[model samples]
Target chain A: MSDIFERIREKFPEYFRSSHSNFGDDTILIKPEGLLPVMGYLKDEEGFNVLMDLTCVDYYGEEERFEVVYHLYDLTEKKRLRVKVRLREEEPVVESLSHMWKNANWYEREVWDMFGVKFLNHPNLKRILMYEEFEGHPLRKDYPLRKRQPRVGPLN
Target chain B: MGVKRVVTGVFGEEGFITTKLDSMVGWARKYSLFVYPFVTACCGMEYMSVSCAHYDLDRFGAALPRFSPRQADLLMVVGTISHKIAPVLLRVYEQMTEPKWVIAFGTCTCTGGFYDNYATVQGIDTILPVDVYIPGCPPRPETVLDGIMKLQEKIQNSKQEY
Candidate 1:
């Protein structure tokens, strides 16, 4: 009932580009430019509906800053798929999936807030956790980990 | 009126004290407790263990939790409070009436643990007035019980009585 990607590979092999480098059976690392089209097909053609979680992993010393992880789930087949999109430290741009899922609104915002990954078409993309006044992205390894307290009151 | 007064005199002050001293009659010790379950993420599940059948909080006479802010006496913040949720949390704490106590449960709530990230609020105490801080990264069931016991001790030892 569930192996939809296998069917895609057999029938429309050109549509599903082979990413042999650092890729798993259910996971694919795609170029930033190819992200939008691939995601659209995955959502519309394949039955992966739920956008479960969107997070990023920082490989600090590397030339590329982060490895963004997008976890998608299919309610019909009860199958899960994870996709990775690698971005350089400077000028990280990926096509936003806000158009596809409502849950992506907060997920993308969090990723932007934490990893500083720029999503081109994301609307109202802001920090979900930190205050507007906060300066640096705390999730970034380069950012210093320091506690900030409100000036109005003594520490509880 | 005179007959009633004579009957009351017969009952006497000694009887009044004795009746109030009885265990079931809680008139003299009416300020029992109304704990606000400030559950955040995971530790809340363990707190359920204490409040539910296994621990039996009613036996101590402090199990009942009042949902409305005005009625509750304690704010048991049981989980992590992110910086984004901090203001709302503070508002909730403010809504609670005077003589309220705050218990910062879990290491994340108390110290923020290994989460040196952007979104996580380092310590809940920085925003709200925390009275008792419980240490544990989502503390174990036994530790939660210990925190409750510690709160009980604090209640007994409190000078400004309710």
Candidate 2:
């Protein structure tokens, strides 16, 4: 743990921010609005070139409704950093990281499609995996497993 | 070994069909079919095998996987499509030139299967038009070929109807 911490502390000082925790893994909470700049520095300065995955979890039972996560990997250093930004149920918005990584385009769209976390600068944030007519975000705890919304009117 | 057998295998002769191929599509339906596999998970691996040298889907004109949806006649949805991936699948289906068909390629895409827990769509049919439903945890290559044959038959029969 100390070694990994030192590695980040030594290599990429500009990208590293304050809250480094030991929560199951080396996780950090970044300011929700500052995701773009921080992510940019990670891509531009550090060698963490790949945004391997982007996902969101609904912490429904808890006070926080959502926790959006981005897993960034440095191919050269073989290091991984998990950046997380929590969001309230309503008014959930975060700056997009689409500019830094092309892969983020599809992944961000997916998170938006499933969890409804609005990515502010995402080029195309429309639903990727569901019909435009789907009633509500199914990943949310409120949605039923077997949704029985009736087919209304003409099938378009 | 001979030109005759190659012709029959390539163009699909009426009486020269293998028993598995016979069961896959009707005598006349097995020819001139194109498939586009919408693969996302482990099942996609099986799909590749069926299309590759081993299983040899080329015998029935389905070995070529079309990149452009415009050229494809069939859509083989071959894995667990999350709520995020489902729309993209539908868009691909919509993008396809008409007279199209769909094979719900495995238990996951056909129905959520073991993933009936959370955020998984029970069946892709709820989202798209499905012609044939193939079942297996991750169906074997043989089973997928069988599903393709069935889809070909469905397509042939539908053509005859019109």
Candidate 3:
């Protein structure tokens, strides 16, 4: 248990779920509602200034189907923290970190494109990797690997 | 030179030769090919090696890469064609002038390689008529040269459009 994790847990006990340290990598599972407050605290107070990555994972059959993961880094303290928010299958929406980090806009767009995870309050939420006409999220577990959509050009 | 020698052998003097306009056009087209390299993925590295001085694509008259499709006579698709890029590839192919040829420069372009997924376009042949297919993940320079030679042979044999 790192000092930062202990402090974060103490600060937001109501929002905190289960947290684990796997091979020195600290990851905290928090409720979707607590995302903004917790991330803001980490960025402003705890010095997790860098949002290294923002991605989503689809657990196809699980109760909480999708997990939006955020990797944060503290440049001054030389530490990394992983924050995850699990969402239900029906409506997987999480608070956008784009306001805090400029790069999160594109990352959120990519996550939306790949996993169909909606980032609420994101300025420009659109497909970043796949084309505009591409249907269905390709990175989801249920997405058929070989299922190709209608092609764009002539079939000659 | 082959046509000249044949004419000289028949007439016993090296003066003039008679040949079909199609063969003459084909011979000229095969010797001066302007390549448009539509490189996207790892195959571009192999393309670079083939076009560079060591491998020398200049031998086949395809050393210069015309960035614009309208200026090129040959379209060399050198890497994976994702579904998103397929439309653009088709547009580029359509932009090229008449008497143009297409070369699928890698296995990805030829047969989609191993990327059998929703994103990747299975093969480029679905959209454009391919003249030559250079099969390799990222084909060696030697294989590319051989493919070019094969294209030259095809050009020399096929009837010219104009």
Candidate 4:
């Protein structure tokens, strides 16, 4: 597994920003532009075929304010890998992985809804949990806790 | 005075019981309340237990969980209601006919439980008027029955709005 990490770093030294393994669990942090290629490599070569989960984290007061985490699973090898990408605070945009993994569509939508991260070329990039009229991304650190956006309606 | 006394004696029958029309209507309404279960979270499991055979809600006259809001007189909101779902809940409440009642059936529905954040609505009453609130993370069946009983008492005395 460490050999795979070393090979990936050797192959794409520019994209492979850093990597750390704790308790035999590997986490690779890569550039935003390199997200698709790294993920493709992990799926096709490293056998991390299943996109288990995709979620985001908010780090307040940071230059790159959001971190999108992708958990990949290999059914045959029974191994797991974590891939992360950092995005800017102003306008976070990343390449959509929906083409490679079908379930990336909704996972990306949820991340976009919660973190306000835009996914380029996403087929349907809309709010999954929150409604469309929802004002701000609730998961963002700067978003006010008590702030509420109520939509008036005829109520059927 | 002699004529009034003779009329009263003839009209007032010994076998019949007399009561106000409103009280009769209230009694009928209390015993025949059709409930709509708007279950959305973990509390739904407990609600199922409340409805099922062991703790059957039928004994209290609220047996059927009507899917259509139009058919139901009682709305049992059985779980957490997020801001996103609040509008939907309101829509369902509005669709219910006059003389309707709402029961906030869990701690999440009563006070948003631990989710004091932006996503979850703190309480459902901000959007819809509630008649009864059963406050538990997921109240036991006994507690749910007690809430039903309380609602029944309220219904028994309430004016027939419809």
TM-score of each: 0.69, 0.55, 0.94, 0.90
- Kindly provide the TM-score of model 1 when superposed on the true structure, using C-alpha atoms: 0.69
True-structure Cα RMSD, model 2? 9.2
Better of 3 and 4 by lDDT: 3
What tens-digit string does per-residue lDDT give for candidate 4 at B98-137? 8899999999999888988777877888788999999988
lDDT of 4 by residue, A1-156 (tens): 788789889988889988889987799899999998889989999899999999999998999989999999999999999999999988799999999999999999999998899999999999998888887888888898777666642221
Better of 1 and 4 by TM-score: 4
Q: Which 10 residues in a row give candidate 3 chain A its minimum summed lDDT?
A: A147-156
Instruction: Say which docking band candidate 3 falls in.
Output: medium
Cα lDDT of candidate 2 equals 0.74
Q: What lDDT is reached at residue B33 by model 2?
A: 65
Q: Lowest lDDT 10-mer window, candidate 2 chain A?
A: A147-156
Per-residue lDDT of B53-140 in model 2, one digit per residue for the tens?
A: 9999988887778887889978888888766566678789999976677889899988778886444667888888798898998888
Candidate 3 whole-model C-alpha lDDT, 0 to 1: 0.89
Off by over 4 Å in 2: A1-24, A148-156, B1-135, B138-162
**lDDT of each residue in B108-145, candidate 1, tens digit only:** 88877777555567788777777778887667767876
Residue A25 lDDT in model 2? 56
Task: Pick the winner on TM-score between candidates 2 and 3.
Answer: 3
**Residue A145 C-alpha lDDT in model 2:** 70
Error of 4 at A16 (Å): 1.4
